[model samples]
Target: MFPLFLWTALLGSAALEGPESRLLCTSPDLSISYSFCGGISHMLSLGVKSCLTKDNTKDDLYLFFVPKRDIIELSVAIQVWFKAVQVAKFTEPLCRGFDDEYSFCGVLKGETINITVPFSYRKFIFPQGQYTVLFEGISGRSNDLIFCVNATVILK
Candidate 1:
C-alpha cells in the first residue's frame, strides 16, 4: 500500500507541466533597449525575482528577476570585447552550482515582445574557452540570494 502511494505521488508531480522556462521576458507592453557600438550592445534590464551582477571594470550588466514555482530566473545582458549576448541562469538555494544553458528565449508573445534572450556573441572573449553568467533564484530553503555573474572571455 505504501509503495503504491509513493508511486502515485511521483507520477502526479511529473504531470505538473508548468510554463516552459524562457531566457527572456517580452510582454507586448514591455521592451528592453540597448545602446550599440563597436560590435557591442548594452542590456537595459532583466526581469525576475533574483540578484545579478557582472565583474567588469569597463563593462556593466543589466539584470531582471521573475518568480517561478521553485526557483527564479536570473537574466542578464553580457557585454564583452565589443559584442553582447543574453543568457538566463537558474539557481535554487539548495543547489550548490549554477546550471548554464538552461534555456534560451525561442518564442515570442508579440511582434514587439520577444520570448527569447537576444545574443550577439561575435565580439566577446572567453579566455577559458567559455564564459558563464550566474544568478540566484528565489528559494525558500535559503534567504541568501547569493547571485554571481562571471564570464571568461575566450577569444576563439
Candidate 2:
C-alpha cells in the first residue's frame, strides 16, 4: 500500500506539469528550410539541416553574410518535478557566412538543465544568389529536450 501511494503521488505530480517549448520566426537574405532539436542536463550543443537552390544559368554572385551581433528570444515549458527551471541568454559571432547561435542555459532546482536554443543572423553571404540555411540544436539529455525552431529563409 505504501508503494502504491508513492507511485500515485509521483504520477500525479508529473501529470501536473507539462514539457517546455518555444517559437521563433524571421526573414533573411537567403531561402532555406530546416529542423532543430535540443536537450540539456549538464551540457549544451546544437544541430542544423539545410539546403540551397540556385539558377545555374544566372551570372549573379551569391553572398551569404553572418551577423557580428544580434539578440534572440528563448521560450521553455516546465514540468512539475522540474519546476524551478531558469533560462539564460547570450550571443556569439558566426564564421564568415554563419554565426554561432545559442540558447540561454536553463536551471531547475539548482541544476542547470538545457532549454530552447534559437538564433538569427542579420546578413549572411552566399556564393550563389540562391541557397539554403539549416540551424540545429543538440543536447546532453536526448529524451528530455526543448526545440526552439524556425524553418524559413527569404531570398535577397
Candidate 3:
C-alpha cells in the first residue's frame, strides 16, 4: 500500500492534468502577442504533468503569436535554471521540423504564427526540486528580442 503522502502526491498529480497548470508569459513586449498551451510528460509513465521529470522527459510546446512586422527568421531558446545557476539549455532554429503552416521561420506582418515543438529531454538529469524555465524567441536576422516567457517547473 502507498503511504498517505504518496497517495496525496499522486492525487495532486492527477489534478495537475485537468487545466490547473498552464504557461503564463510575463512582461511581453507590445510589438508581438504570444500564448502557449502544452505540458510536460514523463517519458516512462507518459503522464502529462505540470512538473518536469529527470532525463527522458518530453515537452509538447504549442505556441502561437501575432507579429506586427515582417519576421524574416526566428530562433528559440529554452533554459532551465536552478537556484540562479544554469543547469541546462537548448537552442535551435524555431521551425526546423515543423510544417510550413506551423512554422515561423518566415512570417509576414499581421500574420498569425502557430508552432508546436516537441522537445526531448534526454541529456540532463534534474534533481527533485523547483526550477525556472525560460522560453525565449528572437529575430534570427537582427538578433532582436521578440518575446520571453518565464515560468517555474518542478522536477520530480
Candidate 4:
C-alpha cells in the first residue's frame, strides 16, 4: 500500500546543483513548480504521496499534494528510466496513506492537503541513471481529472 505523499520528492525543482547536495528531492525547501522539474507533466496542487528521502537525512518531511476535483477513486502508476526512455513500472493505490487527515474514499475539490511528519528511509542504492515516477486520480462518476503529476530524477 504505497501512500501518495511518499514519492513526491521528484516534484522538487530541477535547478539542484553540486554532487552530494545537488539533487535534493527530500529537502524541506523543495518546490512544486513543474517548470523546475524537467520531466514533470501536467499541473498539481497538493494532497497525498509519500517520499523516501536520502537515507542519511532523518528529517521531518512536509507532505503536500494538489487535487483539483471531487475524487471518487484513485488510479495511479509509476514509471522509471529505461534505455533512455521512461517506462511504466507500477500501478497501484496511492491514496491509502491518507488515513488520518485525508482519504480518497471522501470527496475533495480544488483544495490542498498539507501535513508534516518525521520519516525514515531504508538504505538502498540506485543505479546510475534517471528515474521517473508518475501518479494520478480520476473520478469514476464524471470522468474528470482529479490529480495528475510526474517527476524524473537523475542519479550519478
- Which candidate ranks first by TM-score, i.e. highest? 3
Tens digits of lDDT, candidate 1, 1-156: 976775674344223312222243222322222221221112113443222212321222334423222333333333332122334334332332355344322211121221333334345433433323323232333553322222222222
Better of 3 and 4 by lDDT: 3
Please provide, for model 4 over 20-111, each residue's C-alpha lDDT reduced to its tens digit, 9 standing for 90 to 100.
22223433423222221222123333321333445443556454554565554555545554444445567665444246344434546645
Error of 4 at 68 (Å): 2.5
Clash pairs for candidate 3 = none
Give per-residue CA lDDT, model 3, range 70-143, as digits (tens): 56666778876666566878987754333534456567766766666576656755575667666666676677
Q: Which stretches of candidate 3 lie over 4 Å from their true place?
A: 1-59, 95-102, 122-124
RMSD of each predicted structure:
17.0, 16.9, 14.2, 10.2
Off by over 4 Å in 1: 1-56, 69-128, 132-153
Q: By TM-score, how accurate is candidate 2?
A: 0.24
User: Tens digit of lDDT per residue, candidate 2, span 4-80?
Assistant: 87578645533432243221222343444333333221232233322223322112222121211122322233211
Q: In terms of TM-score, how similar is model 4 to the real structure? A: 0.49
